[model samples]
Target: MKRLIATFVTAFLTCAAPVTAAELGDDGLHKTDWMRDTFKDLPEDLAEANAEGKRLLLIMEQRGCIYCDKMHAEVFPDPKVRQAIEENYFVVQLNLHGDIEITDFDGETLSEKAAARKWGILFTPTMIFLPEEVPEGATAAQAAVATMPGAFGKGTTFDLLTWVAEQRYLTDPEEDFQRYHARMIVERNNGNTE
Candidate 1:
C-alpha cells in the first residue's frame, strides 16, 4: 500500500509541474522571445514619419497583448515574412505602456508610452508604414502614408509586406489592397514579381 501511494503521488506531482510552469511562464505580457529582437522602440513623431528611400515599419504593441504575441510567434517568423520585412523596411517595436524613451528622426526624445499616446495608438500590433519624409515638427498631415492595425494572418501579412515593398500603396487605396495582393501572388507564381 505504501509503495502504491508513493507511486501515485510521484505521478501526480509530475503532471502538475508542467501546468504550474506553463502558468508561470506567461509573463502576464504576451511577448515572445523573437519580438525583442525583431521590433525596436521609436518615438511618436519618428514612428509616423517616413525614412525617405528607406522604408520604415512601426509595430505598436502593449504588454499583455495576446495578439501581438501571436503575430510575433506565428506570422513574423515565417521565412517569406521575415525576408520581406528585412528587405524592405526598418522595423521598430514600441511598447504602448512602457516607460522607455526614444528619439525621433527629428532629434526629439519622448517616452515610448508617451509617443504611443501622442499618435493615438490604442491597439497592439499596429503596423504604421512611412513612405516619405516627415518634416521636422510636422504632424500626420505632413506625413504621406498609412497605418495598418491588428494582428494580421500570414497570407495578409505577406501581402502587406509585398505591397509596401513594391510601393503599391502610393496610388492604391485601402480597397485595392486585396487586388494588389492577388496580383503579387500571380506575379510570384509566374516568376515575374520582385
Candidate 2:
C-alpha cells in the first residue's frame, strides 16, 4: 500500500511539472535547438535560411529580462510555438547589448549593439522577420517585412508565425495582422468548450 501511494504521488508530480523549452546559456539567454549559431552576418544568415527553405528570424533579447524569461518559459515552451519555429524559421538570437560583430546586409559592419540601435530596437524580445528576396544595398532593418516588439501570448505568437510563414502579409494586405489575429481569436474561442 505504501509503495502504491509513493508511486502515485511521484506520477502526479511528474504529470503536473511544466515542460522546459530550452536551456540557458552562459550569456544568461535561453538557448533553443531551433536557433542557429551563425557568424551574425545578416546576408549570410539569410542565404543559409533560404538554402534550408526556411525564413530568417532575428530575435533580439537581453539578459535578465522578465519578458524574455516569460517568452522562453511560457510561450516558447508551448508545443505549437516550438514546432512552428523549428519547422519554418531559422532563428538567430542576438543580444540587445552585446558587443559581438555583425555584418549588415548593406555591407556595413557593426557590433550587435550598434545594429540594434540602428534598427531602433529599444525593447527586449524583438523579432525581425525578413523577406526571401532583399534588394541590393538595403540594410536588414530596411528590408524587414514584419517586426514584433514584445512578448505575446501563445495564440498571437502562433498566428504571427503562421502569417509570416504563409506570406499573408503580401497576399492579403486588406486583412492586416491585427484583423487576422482577431478573427483567429474568435475562431479559437468558438471552438473551446471549457
Candidate 3:
C-alpha cells in the first residue's frame, strides 16, 4: 500500500510539472499587445507625427518571417525606440501576403502587399522612407527615398533612425552612416560613459 501511494504521487508530480512550465512560457509569449496594436492599418497616432512635419516610415512584413516577429517583439517595444519612431515618422504597417486596400497619394487603390511589391520590396521587414509629399500620380520608383530590408537590432535600428531623420543618406551614403551613428550615440549618451 505504501509503495502504490508513492508511485501515484510521483506520477501526479510529473504531470503537473509540465503544466506549470507551459503556463510560465505562455505568460511571456502570449502577451503581445504591442505588436497587436501596430497591425493591419496605420495607427491613428501617425497623424500626430504628420502634424510634426515628419516623413513616413512604411514597414512591410510577412506573417511567417521570424525577423519581423523579432522586430515587433524586441526592437519596437523598447521605450526609447518607440518614442523616437512615434515622434519622428508616420508609421504604416503592411502585411506582405494580405489583401487590404490602400489608396496611394496618386488616388490609385492597390492591395497593400501589391503596393509593396510595386516598390521593389523583395524581402520581409522592409522599411521604406517616404517624403512628406509624395507627388500625385508618382510611380513607386519616384515615391521612395530609401529602402532597408531584413531584421535589425535596437542599436542598428536607432542608427538607421537617426540617419534617415537627419537626411544623412543624401550627402554621402558610404561615410555618412558611421559619422551619423557616432553622433547619435554621443547625443544619446550626453558624455556619460555607458
Instruction: Give the Cα lDDT of each candidate.
Output: 0.64, 0.92, 0.65
- lDDT, ranked from best to worst: 2, 3, 1
Model 3: lowest-lDDT 10 consecutive positions: 21-30
- RMSD per model, one decimal: 8.0, 3.2, 8.5
Error of 1 at 178 (Å): 4.1
Per-residue lDDT for 109-177 in model 3, tens only? 688877777767788788877765566677543676767799888877877876777777776777567
Writing each residue's lDDT as its tens digit, candidate 2 over 13-47 gives 98898545667798888898888999998889999
Report how far off residue 73 is in candidate 2 (Å).
0.2
Better of 2 and 3 by TM-score: 2
Best by TM-score: 2
Off by over 4 Å in 1: 1-53, 105-108, 139-144, 171-175, 182-194
Give the clashing pairs for model 1: 39-93, 40-93
> Which has the higher lDDT value, candidate number 1 or candidate number 2?
2
